[model samples]
Target: MDVRTDEIAEQIYRVSVFVPHAGGGAGFTFNHFLIAGDEPLLFHCGLRKMFPIVSGAIRAIMPTDRIRWLSFGHFEADECGSMNDWLAAAPHAEIMHGVMGCRISIADMADRAPRSLANGEVVDIGGKRIRYIDTPHVPHGWDAGVIYEEVTKTLFCGDLFARLGDGPALTESDIVEPAMIAEDFFNLTSLGPTTAPNIRGLAALKPKTLAIMHGSSFSGDAEGAIHSLADHFEARLRMALR
Candidate 1:
């Protein structure tokens, strides 16, 4: 349970905890992103059981109580597992998620009302502006979505390009190979028709940095990597369907 923090982008910190022999394999990393702004935002709360560790990492950068928004791509243990805990810690913190997620889970699950963002909707938290994109079933969850920071060109892509084991905190090298391997192990991507198209949409953003939920954050040709992932999913889906 060794948690550490790294500044992956300007004013954006990655708080990661690595567990060796995770599930008896190569090990895994549970990561969270903190955007330090006037209204600080935290993406992915980590598992509820690891709330103390996650909060501690955040506190290192800024006061845990200063967080104004707690957001996640979808409702999952690694995403919003500690929503209530965050809200309780930060008295004014508001939950932010896709419209569907709000209607499906956040509305009832969160301690306070959540602010639902429709696809393409943007919100400004101090200096950074985040835009929400609805990507249903692209990487599994029907309520899945991602946030893009307009200024930094950073995509808070949850579970997309996820890799197994303890990868580097940030890499400019190829992540596709490892991500494909992890995808094969988890079989997490949906074969839905919208999968490729959704991936392409994110690619269109040409993100300079990918603030991934698991493993390392990519800082290279994110558009190219995304397109590669789209092609990989399309081919895999075609093969499975056949």
Candidate 2:
């Protein structure tokens, strides 16, 4: 089935941000929000190809001289591949990731220093709250996490439920509702069922929205989606035995 994409507005905390970028590239080119605060924040920086769009979107909100906070759910080009580029562009931008991510990026992968985040480690950016929850093995990387913004009800989900040909906008319902996002989610797990257990890990938050770095963000009944996903995994496992 062909799923059409939509790029609608999701107004949060008096901020104007782009939805997600139209897909014609390797990964999801997200709008990447520039949250207003004493020190502003930038969500997932789209793929290297999508950097221009990210730069432009960020430029709209932050001045060229302002320091920015660069963060991602996990380490990937789409999530943070262009880390060096963003660092060069925004010298004031501080690269923040959790311990595993810090280890992988600084010690093993990119080898750049970063501020490590642990579970429940909250960073008050100006006045907004950014809480990190450890999500291991969901994307199968040593360092992985999902960030929750208490101020916006948004969860900066990494690869929890990504899909193909996604729009540049955010929100599960705005483009594709939870039911369909759930379906696409299962499809992804079909390719990587090993991450099944980690899905349950995200359930504790009971997020109102599952803000995946790719595809659509599940906006309603996040725990329900997790349950449904768990059920789907069980069904798949059962069918495989038959």
Candidate 3:
């Protein structure tokens, strides 16, 4: 596994760890997005075992201890597995997540108390304004949610548009098709009634950049890409019903 970091948006860095031959194809990437601001926020904790390398990657941009806010899309291992590890390193860092996540898991799982954000709650982290949206089971996880960086118009959507391979850190190409292909292979998303609607709600944000957790981060027509993904899942739901 090799970890590489790239700035996908203004002061927003995508730290990716690519593992070859792991996703039943070329490989997969466990990506973590670090938002550099007055109160720096690090999204996605990677895995507990990958702490050293992931932390090292983060250290390249800012000191590990300077991170002030920690959050992720869900409570998965790849998302917040290294929760305690980060708290141990960044003494001032506080774990933030959706209300249900904190009530169900984070409040107990985390080494320290967590701040639970209500739906559509926005937290000003210095130069960046992060809005947390509750999206339960859109991709997966009952406590699933996502954060939107207002200044950058970047949506830190976890596991949505997830695909296999070591694509560039950021691309302007079509991500919806590749994501659908990966969906056919992995079937990782929890397709249900709210799946398409939840994604469509995100499209309404009209994001210019999509900070994806796997594969590549997209920087072009983000709204269209998100809507297309919703359409695909809606079609799947129709097929499943038939």
User: lDDT for each of the candidates?
Assistant: 0.89, 0.60, 0.94
Candidate 1 vs candidate 2: the lDDT winner is 1
lDDT of 3 by residue, 1-242 (tens): 87899999999999999989788857999999999999999999889988999999899898999999999999988899999999999999999999999999999999999999999999999999999999999799889999999998999999999988988999999999989989999889999999999999999899999999998999999998998999999999999999
TM for every model, in the order presented, reads 0.98, 0.73, 0.98
For every candidate in turn, the CA RMSD to the true structure comes to 0.9, 5.4, 0.8
Error of 2 at 216 (Å): 2.9
Q: Model 1: clashing residue pairs?
A: none
Candidate 1 C-alpha lDDT tens digits along 86-205: 999999999889899999999998989999898999999999998999999868888999999898999998999888888778999888888999887887787777888899889889
Candidate of highest lDDT:
3
Q: Which sections of candidate 2 miss by over 4 Å?
A: 1-31, 107-112, 166-194, 237-242
User: Model 2, residue 162: displacement in angstroms?
Assistant: 1.2
Model 2 per-residue lDDT at 168 = 35
Candidate 2 vs candidate 3, lDDT winner: 3
40-59 in candidate 2: lDDT tens per residue? 76667546765665565556
Ranking of all candidate structures by their TM-score, best first: 3, 1, 2
